[model samples]
Every structure is written in C-alpha cells, then in structure tokens.
Target: MIRKHDSLIHQILAREIPQYVIDERIRNILNFIKFGIESGIPANGKEDEDNNTAETSAFIRQLADDAIVLLKNENSILPLKPEENICLIGPGAVERRTTGGGSASLNSYYHTSVADALKKKLGHDVPFAMGSLIAKNLHDLGEVVTNPKGKGFDVKVYKESFDVPEEKRTLLENYSIDVSNLLLFDYDPKGCENSTYYMQLEGDLTPDKTGEYSFREQCLGTAQLFIDGKLVIDDKTKQGLSSGIFASPISSPQIVNVKLNAGQKYHIKVEFGSGMTFTARKDSAALVTDSASILNFGYIFHKTDEEYIEEAVELAKKSDKVILCVGTSLDYESEGFDRSEMKLPGNQEELVSAVLKVNKNVIIVNQSGTPVSLPWIDNVPAFMQAWFNGMEAGNAIADVLYGDVNPSGKLPLSYPKRVEDNPAFLTFKSNNGQCVYGEDVFAGWKFYEKRKIAPLFPFGFGLSYTDFTIDNIATKLDGENLEATVDVTNTGKVTGKEVVQLYVVPPKTTTAVDRPLKELKGFAKVELKAGEKKTVKIEVPYKYAASYFDVDANQWHAEKGEYGVLVGDSSSSEKFLESTFTLEKDELWSGL
Candidate 1:
C-alpha cells in the first residue's frame, strides 16, 4: 500500500517528518495486513478472508468442488448425499499440484492434491483408495556446449579468456563476477550484439601468470585448467547448461577439465558467426556456440500419457462425477521454443480419450498459454479453462467451483484446430538465420480473418453455469474513449457472473489491415442473483485501443470508423445487446 510517494518511513528518514501521524497510519494498514494474512487460511472464527491471494486451507476444498465439473452425475451420487461406494483409483487422484508452467508457475503454501482434497471432502462417505503411480522415474535431457573456434562445435575443450577487438576498447575492461570481496578477476573481451562466437583451449594449460591467481587443475574447455596450483575439476573437457531457458552456468553447477600441459600458457582464441550469438576468450580468439540446445527441464518431470491416463481412469471410477484434470503444460508452448508439431501430444489426446470412455460423466479442464489442439473436445461433456493463474490458483479455482465465486474468465486468443492451419507455421521454425514476420502484424484472431480459417474454439469462449441476457446497449463515444451502458439480468434459477466484453471492427478500406471481424477491447466481470437486473457500464478505445502492434505505421493505430459495442456471455452467442456509431472527425493518438 505504501507507494513510493506515500512511503511514510521514507518521508520521515529523508526529512524529519512528524512521527505521530505516520505511526497511526502504520497501525491501521498493519492491522489490515495482519487480518488479510490470517484470513487467507480458515479463520478460527472469521467471516471472510482478505489476503494477497484469496487462499485458505478451505481453498483447496473449494477449488476441488468448483473445478469438479459434473460430466456425468448419474442418479444423484454427487453433492454426494448418500455418496455410493467409491473406488478412487489413480496416483494422480491424490496429488494434482497444477497445470501449465513458466513465470506463472507458483508453489502454494499448502495444497490438497486432488486425492487429498477429495478424501477430505468425501471422507468415509466415499472410500478412498490408491492406484499405481503414473510414472516411477521420469527424466528429460537439457544440454549446452561451448568449444574452440574453427575446431568445430563439440563437447570438448573450453577456453576461458577471449581476444579483444582491435577497433573497440577491450570489452573485458570492467566486468566483475562477485565471487568474493577484494578478489575481483577480469573476464575476457566484449561481445557483439546479435552475434555468436566460439572459443577453445587447444589442450591443457600451464598458468601464464600464476603466482597469485587461484589456479586449480580441472578438465574444461577441451583442456585441463590450472590456476596457481589447485585442481578444481578433473578428467572432463567442455561443459554448459543443458536444456531449458536457464542455459547459463548460473543454474548449472557441473564442469569438466581436460589433461594439463605441464609448462606453457594456454592461449585462448575466438571465432565469430555473423548474425548469430557472440563468444570471446583470452584476448586471442572468439567463442563458438554449441549446436542447438535442448530445453526440456519442465517436461522431464511430467507424467507420461499412459501414466496420467491410467491415473485419471482410476480417479473417475471412484467418484460420483469424474473431474478429469488435464491441459497443455509449459513444455507444450513457450516464447523462444518453437513447437515442432501443432497437434496435441499423442499420449495426451489418447489419455483424455481413454478417460472419457471409462467415465460416462466426465469434465475436461485445459491449461495453456495459448490454445492447443482439442481433438477430444466433442467427447467430453464439460470444459473448464484455468489459465496460468497466479499464487491464488488453488483457492481461486475452489471459490468458483463451490459457488463461493462464479466462473467469469474468457479466452483472449483463438484455439486453432491444427498447427498446419496457422499462417506462421510455414516460417516458424526457420534456419535461414532470420525470422520472417510473413504475416505482417495481424496475429491471433486477426490472422484468422486473413486466412479464412475458423478456430476450434474462438477467442472469448467461456461458459457459465447460470444463464444471463443482455438488453439495451447504448454507445457513448468521446473521441478515443467509448463508454457503453447495458442492462443485464440473470435468466436462470441460479446466481452467476458474466463478463461485459467490448469489441471493435474497423472498416475494410485500402489502408485498413485485415483484422478480426471483432476484437476484445475491454471487459468487466458482473455478478447477479437469479432474476436480478442491473445496468453495467463498459468502455472501449478507438485508435488508441490497438494493443497488438502494427509495424507499417511505426505506431499503434485504430482506424476511425463505426464500432460495435457487444455485451454477451461469450463470443459465439448471439444473445447480446449491441449498437454502432462512427468516429466522424476526432481521432485517437497512435499508440504505436
């Protein structure tokens, strides 16, 4: 709560600001903070929670309940009134941490894995039993290699220093690694941006300047290294980070050293590759990069299709309703990692299909950064998407499922049927040393309009248990900002929440780029009791609303034209209130 400007502690330290007022506000905020933290978990007797993440021990139970979709609730076994004899099977039935990964990945303070949560929820009412582990031991490989220039890229020889460029000051002038205080050592020369270099230690080394340097003999850089006279590593040559985004040695602790040359200074050299990465060593040679590095750290630990599927089947058979949790994990899609194939992993699809066959009533939940192929969509009765939610995932998911909170999330990207259908697939994994943005700037839903391909699940697709209706949409445009007022009512018997979404469709003109027929600009989550009615306000931007970059204009641009204001539960439904208006003169700034 203490923004830079409102930091009372800062103000008091910088200037002798009064302490009385600051002390009082501290008490108030601290009290709230304390309550918030305590409330996340079940309060011994508190009414509700107010923490950074809406989590509590009950959160696990809540998520399991809300997330557990009733794909098949035959004969009222669920809400498990007289909950029948259950045979909960599957290793996963007991522990399900989460789906998806990356920066969004978080560790819950405490978790009730699917099995633990179910057992806690159903207890003796449903007999809990364990199934076989999906996988006994799983490992994924990750590798990185560095070698001497011109000697070819191989897992041998590592040169520690690099050659300095004649034209520029030595790049190593002031580089420092914090190994210890008062013992800073100089690194090799500078590196070129967007360039790659390779270096090699021909073989073993006799310290050139050894009196004071901490020299140890260890095998590395295709050669043995010796500082002064100590051996740090032995027998191995070159080594580097293997696999994953953490390719640097900071995350890799192992190294190898080669045989040592008894009495000579090992000279370092560098070899540079144009338009690639750069490496340099010992003011003598350029560094060389290993072949492509494979990063599968996350996938290494994932359960196999057979393992996960087997687990799911067992879990499904034991419950009144089978909540089969599955989705695209981090390894499936990433920013730098190019996907080799667009189809769902063979085992993943097989797993879901197999689970569906065993459980007549099955709920399929998917997690992905972007959309993935869902060939089993038609087989599953219910679908829930829990995107990369933050630390509050366990509790948040629980809230929505138990009717404590309503599901109001909507997809922001289109889910394609196949990868081959994408416009970027042709040049995506290119080796020409260049990335060709062949599709210009039109991406996501916009590209679909250009290619005339319908997505398996359109952007803005999400379902709600309760029904809602949109009535009377009125548009109020003020140059760049557009405000909309619409009346919404819960038409179903149960209470629910709905997202008020706004979309803009630019006119098809010579200058207008092929854009999505409609794009999500802004949205609001609104809740209503059954038969309850309320008018909600939403806003949209004109030219300033272009969030996806457009390169041609060197600026973000939205064309001045009539725009649509849509209010509905999802993109596919026609059950909405909409109106149109034109931007005749005023223009929103180029947010490019």
Candidate 2:
C-alpha cells in the first residue's frame, strides 16, 4: 500500500484543492453532526417524533390519491359499488410495497396492504388469492418470523468469526431488528467501524399451513442458515454472482427446501460474517466490500404457478366484481439494474387473461414506477396506474376505487403499444460499453407524434369520472413570455379536475434540421364544480416555448414565423383546440 505522501493522486489532489475549500467542507460536516447530536436524534431513526403525524400522513395520502392515473375506464366501470362482491387477486395485493428498493427504499413506521385496506372499506374480508409470484428473489421472512417475545428477530453481534469458539468470541452488541432484508451500508457500531464483525440472528417461525417450505439466503459476505439446529443453507464457501444491495456483486440466493408442519414452531438461526469473510474474487462492478455488508433472506411455501392461477380464477368466477392488483414490485423494477423486458414478471399476464375470461367486471390496478406491457389492455374494462406511493399507498388506491377521491393525475410519459414502438428500441442497451443516442430529439410523446404511431396511452392522458370542455382559447405576449388562456367548463353532473396542456407547433424551417411536430410547453390543472366555468392561464418564456437549439450558432433561436398553440387534455392531435401567434422578428439568446 502506498502512503498518502508518496501517492501521486493524493499529491495532485492536495495541490489542486484549496485549503479553505477543504476547511469549509469539514466545518459543514461537523456542524451537521453537532446539530444531530444536540437535537437528540436517535441513531436508529426510531424516535417517536420521526414518525409521520396525522396531518402529514393525510397530505401524503392526498398526493398519492391525486397522482394515480385512470388509463382506461370503459362503460363507467370504476367507482365500484358498495354491494359488489369483490375479489382482490395478485402478489401486489398482499405485499406492502410502499417504495422501490436500493437507495429509494425505506423502512416506514407502518403501512397497510391493499388487501387489508379493501377489507376495512368493505367492513369484511374479501376473497383474495396470490395469482402469481413476481418476486425475483425469495420473499421477505420479516412478517413470518418472530422471537420468544413475539418480536421480529434477536440479533447478536461479535468481533470474531463463527470459526472462533463461543467462549473466546468477543461480544460487541445485541439488538432487535424488525426486518430480514438488512442493508448495513451505513451501519457503524462503536469500535467496529473499521473491523470485521459477525452477527447471529434468532427467530421462531410458525406456519399456518403444512407444506414443503423453501428458504433462500443471499449475502454480500458469508452466511449460513439453520432450522431446528440443522444447517439448511451455507453461502459461506461457494457463491454465485448477482446484483445485491447497493448494486454490489454478491452471491445469488442459495435455496433449501424443508418439510414444515402447520402450527408447529420452528427455531430459526442465521450466522453472517462481514464482507471480509467472503472468499470470492473481487468484482469490478461491486460497490460495497469490507466496510459494510448486506444480508437478504426469505422463505415461502412451495406451490406451482398453475395451482395459484387456478385458485384465483375460481375466486373470480364466483365474485360479482374483481380487482386484480398486478404489477412489478421492488424486486423487478428497482434502481440496481434495468429490466430486460417490458412484460409483467412471472405468469401475471396469464393470470389476468384467466381472470378476465371468468369475469368481465374486473378492474386492474397496476403498481409500478415505470411502464409494463399490457397484453390484455383491450380486454379489461378498467385499468389504473398506481406508482409506488409511500406509506399511504393502499389508502389512496382504496379512495380512488370507491369514488372517495377523483383521480386527476395524468401520464407523465407515453406508453408504447409494444416495446418495438419505442424510439430507442434498436439502441436501448449498451453496445461495447458505449450507448448510442439513436433516437435523437424524438423521445416520449415527441417520437410518437413525429412517427404518427399511436401509443397505448399518450403523455398527459387520463380519464375523469366527469366530463369537461375546453374552448375560447386565446394567447398574447407578455414581454418575452407567451401567456395562453382558455375557458374550461365542467360539463358533467359531478365535480372533477382537468389538466390544460399547451403544445407549440414551430413553423416549417427550410434548414436541414428536423424538429418534433409539436412539443408541450406548459400546463395547468383546474378543479371545477358541475356546470361551472373557469379560465386557466398558462405562461411560458417565448424562447422556451418556440425555439430549438441551433448547433451552428451555439444558441437557442426562435424563428420569425407563425407558431401554433394547441390546448387539450392529452398529446393526441385530434383532441386539440388550435390557435396561432406570430413573432415579428427572430430572437436568439442563451444562458439562464
């Protein structure tokens, strides 16, 4: 190892970095630490005051409620009737996936699952089934395992490895953790920050149904699982490469099947050593190493995909209405890696198809942060996009389904009818460690409109329970900004919100440069009561609304020509109310 003084990189950094800059950074860090300590903040982030208050929670619920987009609602199937016999089916229904995984993941104070929320609203339990398994890894055992006191898990930390004798090992700390998906990237125990450590977790599992249970273990370090004091999985010696927590290259989960009995308590123990104990060769892509470790283990009762689908179909056949909650969870659509395909994980498509055949009164609610292929789009009468909404996700979704809240959220991005329709379909992945921007300016709604390809749903597209009309459009130049105003009336019998989207169509240029047919410039959302009219005004800088970057001039240029302004609810041209404005002379400028 090279000393700091002898290292060339360190020498250069010292020479280039100013002393005051370094001092300022250190001072800021010290001040932050002082504030945290003085404020009596808990290191574990479990303080009572840290939890969301009633008001904050309500606000979060409202945001989630408004952000849900009603993509498709035919025959007014939404706002489910109270008397409808509803059945909730899918893996997402039972999973409390409030957020995505990786850095975006967090341990919420509490969260309600869709199944529980629906049950509460109905005043009784509804027919439910796990139609398919979409988890890329084993399911978390946090909800299944408990300690002697009926708690999550008992954890014991040590400075020595498992190879050391029990009496010789030095105990470092002991605590209780509520979850099995442990990401210890920021874990810094007293006196153990720079040292290798080991942990032992003990828990008891009682299954409700007897079956062959499958347990899986994956770790950034080395780990072993024991059930009833028998070694079930040993990931310490041999390991396989896969992306783990923090995008680190770690072992692929090792699974073992054990026959378990119903209502019979089983003793569970796990021994884990820090990354220093890992014997695998260092991978170039691995981010975490000796400084931290991650351990994710889970278990589930073994069942075939066909059996699960059959059960859901049976429930759908008997119910008067079905809410099939299907989509990718954190396991499939997290930050670590890009999804290889656009289709739903596992046999979810099959489950949706099967359910639709049995019952036509079905509503599909997809909870995903990104787009997923909907093969049954034409078949389903109602569909919704519920992105990963934090703690109040279930409550918000319940509100929309029962008509307590009107969904006004519009699609932020266009959904391609097929993956092939995407602008970057041919060059989406990296080639020879270099990615080509093949699509150029044609992206999202721009690409769809330019190619005249109809998307599954256009950007800014959303359906409301009530109807709205847009007319009397006008525009004027306020200095360098163009202000567009339009009269909106809630024509339906109920109150609703409408988004007024403004798009600018630039004049056809004789130059070789090509541009999008039309581009969205500004938008405003307006809420109105039945038979009420409201004028909404949207303003955009003239350059921002009508200019394109001129490569030769190295600046944005607004050509001296007529520019058309289109106002509508979505990107589809047929729905737009058109008007025109002209610039007397060309304008060129740069910088914010």
Candidate 3:
C-alpha cells in the first residue's frame, strides 16, 4: 500500500510536493530498503539478492533429485527393504567416478562413495561381492601376456611399471599409444603441433631390476589400445577421445599388480633417443602416504555395453533391488567433442535390458548433461536424472530415495531421442580441431523448437513425485514495469516443492533473432503440503520482456507491439496459462 502511494507521489511530484510528505515518504522507503539489505538476502553487492534460486540447501537437493532419472525398474525392486546379507558387485558399486575428466571438475574435502554410503546406511554385517570384469580381465591379460619379448610373461617375479602420459593420450598417433619413457608432464602451452620436448624420469624406478633391458624402437601406428606385437586400435577407428585434449587415462590398474620390496634397489632406463617427448602423468596420487581420501573417485572402465550388462546382472541377483548407477565414461563423453551417439554409453542400455530378463524390477540412475535413448523406458517402473550433481550427488540421491527430501529441480536442457535429432548433429563432429558453437544461445530447447524437431525430453522436463496446479495468470503494468502473479497449490498426498516458472515472448517486430516461444524470465521454488496453496508474484522490467541485441543495428530496439507471457513446468509442453502484454519503444528501458 505504502509502496504504491510512494510511486504515485513520485510521479505526481513533477512540479512539487508538500515538504512533510516528501520527508515521510523518503524516510519510509529508506528504512524498508535498509531492512531488506540487512536481512541476509540471496543476492548482494551488485548481485540480485532477490534471486531465491539457491536461497537454501533445497536447491542442492532439488538439483540432486532432478538429475536422478530412474532408467529401469521392472518389478518393485527399488527402495529395497532393509534386509542384510546382500552383496555389492561391479567395480562401480565400490568406487564411483563422481566427476569425469575436464573443466566440469572440482576437488572437495569428502565424497560419499557408494561402498561407504551403503556401509554407513547398512551395518558391517552386510555381505559384499566383487565380480570379474571381462574388459578389465582382458586388460589384465594384455599386461600379463606381454613381456617386451624377453622378460618372460610367466616369470614368478612380477615387477611392473607404466607411464601415464602427461597430456592425456599425447602419444596417440595413428590410434596407437604414444608412450614416453620420461616421467615428465607435457602440455602444448602455445598449442604447438608435433613438437619436440625432453623430460627425465626422476622417480624411484630403476632399469636393473627388470634384468638386462635394452631399448627397442618399434614402428607404433595409430591405435588407442595396443597389445603385444599388434595394433588393436588405429587412426581409422573413431574412438577419438584419445586425441589432443582428451588425455584419456590408460587402463593400467596393473601398475599395482606387482610388488616392489623397499630394501631392493635397481637401475632402469628407456632412451627416448631423439624422438618427440611428452609429459608422463602420475596416476591418482595421494597428497601424503597410505592415507585414503574420503572420496573414492575412479572409473569402472567397461569398453562395451555387453561388458556392463554381464557385470550388472550378477549384482542384481545378489541384492534385493538393483541400483544400476550407469552413464557414459570420460572416453565417451567430454569437452572438445559432442558424443557420437546419445544412447546410454556402453552396455548401460543393454545392461538395463538384460537386468529386466532376470529380475523384472530394477532402478536405473543416470548421470549426463543430455538425454539418452531409453529404448526400454516403457518397460521401466522408476527413473532418475542424475546429471553430474556435484559433491552433493550421493547424499542428495540417497536423501530422496530414502524419502528425506522432495525433488524440486526443473530441467535446464532438452534431451533428444538420439544424437541425430539435435540441430548440431549434422555438423557436430570435430572439424579442423574446432567444434564451433555457431548455434549461439539458440541451443537445446530453442533450436529444437525453431527447427520444428522435437526433443525426447524437453527442457524443464523434470518429474516430481507430487503434483502442482497453476492458476490465475494475471499481469499488472505500472509505468515500464510488469508484475506477474499465479496461484500454485500442492494437490498431492505427499509433500513436495514446485518451481513456479515465468517466461516472456517478445513481439515479432521487436527483434528478428531465433526466439523461443518463451524464454525463462524467472522461477520460484516453493514447498507445500497436499492441501497447501500460495500466490507467487514475479516482477519484470520491460527490458526483461523486450527484445534486445540487434546484430545489424548493434543497438537494442523494442517495437511497440504485443507480447506473450507463459508460465509452466516444462519449457515445451505443460499446462500453463498465458496472457498477452504490450511494450513500446520508449517503455522498453528505464533510465532510472
């Protein structure tokens, strides 16, 4: 009431105002503004404190909940009842790769490993199982069978050493591992190509321990994976993650297969001679000694989906419900390149398929930035969309699964049924070492709508265990500002949170860019019980609804025409009520 009167007073005071009225209004506004600043708002100091997106830990929980997509649940196999004596199978069930390679990585104090998490949830008496991964077992074979032609593969004295390249697969030439003997880090600071550099091995490794070893220069060709005297992978194969920026980790867990007695000493040497030298990468090293990090991060490294299924089926049989936490590994997903396909990498799809054959009921939790083709989504009962939900992943998922929190996250991107459906798919492959993001801001949902191609899962397409109803889409215009209000109610048995979203559509003549039917302007996450309801008011300036940025004009132009306001759940399909509003050239911006 006072705010409206004050605005009126300001407009009416173009000529003058009573001295007493001016002083009283100024003092009230200042006092209210001061109180708001000191109240610990979300944004401050140039930050919009009114952005309540992450006002509390609920945002973390919402992100965690929304990212967990239950891919498969055949029978009532999930939310496993508390029964002891179950086994934890597969390499992943023990150690999880919370974060994959590249920029989306963060180091943290503690991470909840599935083993540790389950152990904490279930007591010490729970039985655990470890299965032989065919892929990893084959890796074991490669290391065990190869002896440099003289060390004797069957020698009882097992002394192993491996060189992890400093620059991912820096030695990746023609698809063959370009390994360097020098234990040094190599990175092209200037993006140099085929450059020569030198580094020396300074670690405790010696050459004499492996008997008399001599340098053998073999013509190694392209192949990410190479075996004794044979090239298993090469340039023609598209397993290109081994290229420049990937720095894919080698499957050399065999590094720990052998033992080195501390008292013994030996000298080892590998003469790089006069060849190109890249840095050697050290495996996940510890900050100190034998102290294990609270977080267990490493890949299960299954090459094919069949391999994943074989490992997963054994796990499903052992436990009451199958918590098949699966997704693409670093090799299949990373920066510099989009994925070749959108299907769940490896045997995840196949794993989900096969798991249903044995135990009809299973719960699939996935982690990825995009949607994967769930050929069998119709067969599954429960799903989760666990999209790289940072350090809070395991805790948040566990919290929701155990009914500790209500899932309130809305989708930020759309998921196509296949990689082919995406607009960038035609020209997406890495070309000339550059995968240009020419699509500009019109990516994901915007492009999909523009091209008339549909996404398998639309943006803001998150599912909640509860339901919400949005009513009364009304707008009020005061000068150049608009206030949007909608009534939201939780009309479900369970308590849940609702993401009240607001979207704005500019007039056709305002701008000529690829505009979405509506762009997300504002959203509010509110918690409510089964019979609870509340009116959420979201305010927007004409600038927010106006079309800005003209590539030709290099200036913002707002046409005096009609605009549309949409409020809904998903960016594409949802029951949202909309109303038409207007903007004028002069009303688009407020110099004030």
Candidate 4:
C-alpha cells in the first residue's frame, strides 16, 4: 500500500496523472476497504475446496490422469496388475508433492502420498522406504517446531552478520512466524540499505521418531545452522549462482549428522546472510530487481546414503516390480531459479543405479515440471513423467499404474540428451546485464531438427497402454485459416487419448532472415475406444503459418511461399502424413 501510494504521490507531484483521476482511484480504494471492514470477513476456504465437489473432483482426477505422459515402455511393462506385489521406492514415493516450491506451493484440504494411494488401490500393505532424502524445506516443517506459546519459530533481523555487540545490535523485527521458510524480499526490513542483510531464527525442535537426524541449509545467500549450541551445517563461504529458476546462487546442502531420542528437545538457531558474491558464467543473466531472496532451510530425519540405497534395493528384490518414483524436487527446480544442470540432485543417482542393478522390472515414475537427465533410462523398463499433478498426486499415479487410467499426455517440451545439446546451451544465460537469444525461433524440436541433434525424448512424445495411428490426412484453406483434418484410429485393445500435433514445414524462401525448418501450428487431444476411429480437425491461422516478423518494416509479413502440413502424434513420430497448402498472395499484420 505504501509503495503504491508513494508512486501515486510522485505521479501527482510530477503531474503525470490528473489530480482528479488520482483522487477517484484513492476514493475507490478507501471505499472498498471500508466496505470490507464493515461487512466482516468472508469464509476463505482452501484452494482445493473450490473444486471439492463431486463433479469437479472427478474432473480434477481425470485431468491428472490425462496429463501424465509415458516416455518409455520396454517390453510392455506398464499398467501393472493391482494384485501384484509392488515396492514403492524413493523419497517422492511417500511424499505428496502436489505442487512446487515458492509461490506455486498450495495448501490443500487433503493430500494422498503415492504410498498411501498405492495401499488404498492394492488393498494391502505396500512396502515403502525413503530411498533418498528429498528434504522438505523449512516452510513444510509445520508441526515439528515447539515453542512456549504454540508451534512456531522466533525470528530476528539484524543489520550485520557479526562484529556488533549483542546489546548494541539494532533489532529490525523480532516476531513469531508459523513457517521456517522466509522470503526476506517480502519483509522489506528497514535500516538495511546495503546489498547484505542478516537474520537469526530461534526455534525448539522435537523429534517425533527416535533416529539419526540430519540438518541442512539451502538458501540463495549464506547461512549456518546451530543445534543445541553446536554448529552443525555452515554454508557461509559456499555461495554460487545456478541456472535453476527458484534455487539460484545454489549451494549444496552442508549437512551434519546427530542422534536424538523421541520427544527430546533441542534449541535451534539459524543465522543467515541475504546476499553473496559469486563469479558466474560470462553469459549468465544479471541479477534483476525482482530476483528472489529465499531461505529453504530445514532439517529432516536422516539415513546414510548407503543405508537408503541398500534398503531400496532389498525392497526391489522382494517385490514383483518396483515403482521407483524419481525426479527433481522443489529445491532442485522451481519458479524463480532455473536448474543449473539436468542431473538428479544428491544421492538419487546412486539410489536409482543401485536399484536398477537388482531389479529389471523397475518402473521409473518421474515427477518434474521440466526434463531431468536420466542416465538410467535404458536400464528401466518403463518410465512416466508425472509433472507436478495437483492434490491427488498419489491417487493419479495409482490410477495409471493399476490400469484404471490410460496415460495420454504429450511432452510440451523436448527432452535433451544432455544440457550441451540444448539449442541455447552456449547462450542460455545473460552476460553482464544482457541476455542474447542466439537460437531464436529455432527452439525445442526446431533446433534439434535443424542441427541434426537427437533428443532423448522429442517434443509431443508420449505413449499409451494402447496404440494409435494417424491416417487419411487432409488440408484445405478456409477463409483466413488452414484446416488440417486427419482420421485417428485406436487399433490397440484399450481405450486411450492421443494428442494430434500439426507442424508447418515451410519451403525454401529467398528471404535472408533465419527461419525454423518446421514449427508447431496446432494441436488437439482426442479420446477413442479400441477399434474406434475419429476424424479430428485442427485450425491454424493462414497468417500465423505464412508470416515472419519483419525487422525493417516492424511488422509481420506473410511471404508468398508454399508450405506443407505434417500431421502426427509427436514431433519425431515416423507415422506422420504430409499434405501441401499454398497462400495466394502476400499479407501483412501489425499490432498483436
């Protein structure tokens, strides 16, 4: 409010906006605030509550069922029988990560972890283990902190990290907050004008289960963890930049192992510094004004990496098949920070590798918003990409695994074999304060097609428990749009959905500007039963396919050229049918 009001005041002083207009806006705001205060507060339900009704709930489940994409299925190992004994392995197995970290996180009415969902569906015990520790951040530690008043932590912001005497140190804000995760940017503390700021968080931690505990710190800047007055994890000097959107200035978790008994109390003090200096790649993006200041600090019940690996392998040996839930976590990939690399974080690589050696019937169910390097792709028989499906994360996985839902999701983005194969690899990050998009227009499949690079998984690639074939493809010009119609036949034994992708392959043009070899023009998702055939039509604007941005003219002009329509299930699908279409004359468009 202050910031907006200050801006308005500046505008009024500068006479940028009329005084009457500003007055009316201020009056409207005041009236709304008065009305809200007088009318009391409305009942604010949880985010999931809006869709908690029966119809909406079913639609949500279907949405989840449809969004899941099957990337690989070697020897037809998917759609596991419900009666089969399955061992759920990996940290994501029991954890209900229905959402990502930061602002994308959600508070739901109920959440069913994969372990719980599997148990419900199988109607028996589903053996599970923490194959790896994908530690929940400080904010997710809701019930562990025990203070005198209630469950919360005490926080104090200071102007400096050290050298200030306790009595002389100025207090910025000392308050009790419910969550451990703190975004200092939102707080906007006073008296800290420099790039650096410090914080001290005090809390009481009581272990519910007696076992070896591990504490770690993950922050954009630097931090130290002190348990019972003994320094455990210190990441003060370990500051670096990362490509991940949410986990920037990435520093590996500096963990410390400690043993504690159930119900035992420990005093925890976390000291933090908000800014760090680091050398980034010459092409790294500069720190924008809206860059995040995050603290994903917390500790979790710990087991040795070797211990986790052994237990998962043992579980895999006992079961008929293993549902190895693996992928990047919120800390590895999120909204603000781009991931530094494509590899899975921490000891996950070792865990999966060990599990694969003993179990050939391993089904890797990966959950991520984007691609992660799968070094063991060939070793696993089946793989599915369950990108952050909402509230029913576990139930959705069970639905697909138990053959209740046929996977029909298509990859929205291409999966690179390695980070180096990415079109923007050499110029992905910005240099100094400038970012150069060297591979403009030729992103994703276009880049791969142009460079003759084979992606691990091409864009629009997905498999189902059934089969589909695109036949009798036809294209016609209707008014200002090009209509491409194709007959989609489900020849397999089960009912499933398929996303029909339409790509426009332009002919050789005399224009000097660079252009992609082919571009996605339209797409449609159609469901069909076994032996059922449906004709699906996708419409693409004639100008969209025929036009290219003209820099000199500062407009988009449709070149007088011939183009062909490629219809298929995926970008790299060999089953595509081609048909040509032409534009009669040149056309120009301005102002999107």
Q: Local distance difference test, per candidate? A: 0.47, 0.85, 0.50, 0.77
Off by over 4 Å in 1: 1-112, 124-320, 330-339, 342-346, 395-404, 508-513, 545-561, 586-592
Candidate 4 lDDT over 1-592, as tens digits, reads 1234455668779998898996897899999989977886654532335657778667778888888988898888888877677888987887656777657775565667788888788777788878887654522543457666666677778776655876777778777666566554454577875545677777888788999776656666677788899977877754444533322345554556789889888898877776432223222233332223556666677767788889888889898899998876666666656777888876788888898888888898998888888888888889999988887778898899888999999998999989899998999887997999888888788899999999999999999999988899889999989999999999999999989999987767636678887889899999999999999999988889777898888899887778878999889988689998987677778965
In candidate 4, stretches whose alpha carbon ends up further than 4 angstroms from where it belongs are 1-56, 103-110, 134-140, 143-179, 188-208, 217-256, 263-295, 432-434
Q: Can you write out model 1's per-residue Cα lDDT over 103-160, one digit (the tens) per residue?
A: 3444444334444444444554334323222211121111111233322122211122
Which regions in candidate 3 have their CA more than 4 angstroms from the true location?
1-92, 124-242, 246-308, 314-320, 330-332, 335-337, 430-441, 508-514, 586-592
- What's the best-to-worst order under lDDT? 2, 4, 3, 1
Q: After superposition, how far is residue 194 of candidate 3 from its true place, in Å?
A: 17
Over all chains combined, what TM-score does candidate 2 have?
0.90
| Model 2 alpha-carbon drift over 4 Å, by segment | 1-51, 148-150, 185-190, 193-195, 242-247, 283-292, 510-512, 552-554
lDDT of 2 at 196: 70
Error of 3 at 423 (Å): 1.5
Lowest-lDDT window of 10 residues in candidate 1?
176-185
Per-model tally of clashing residue pairs: 69, 0, 41, 12
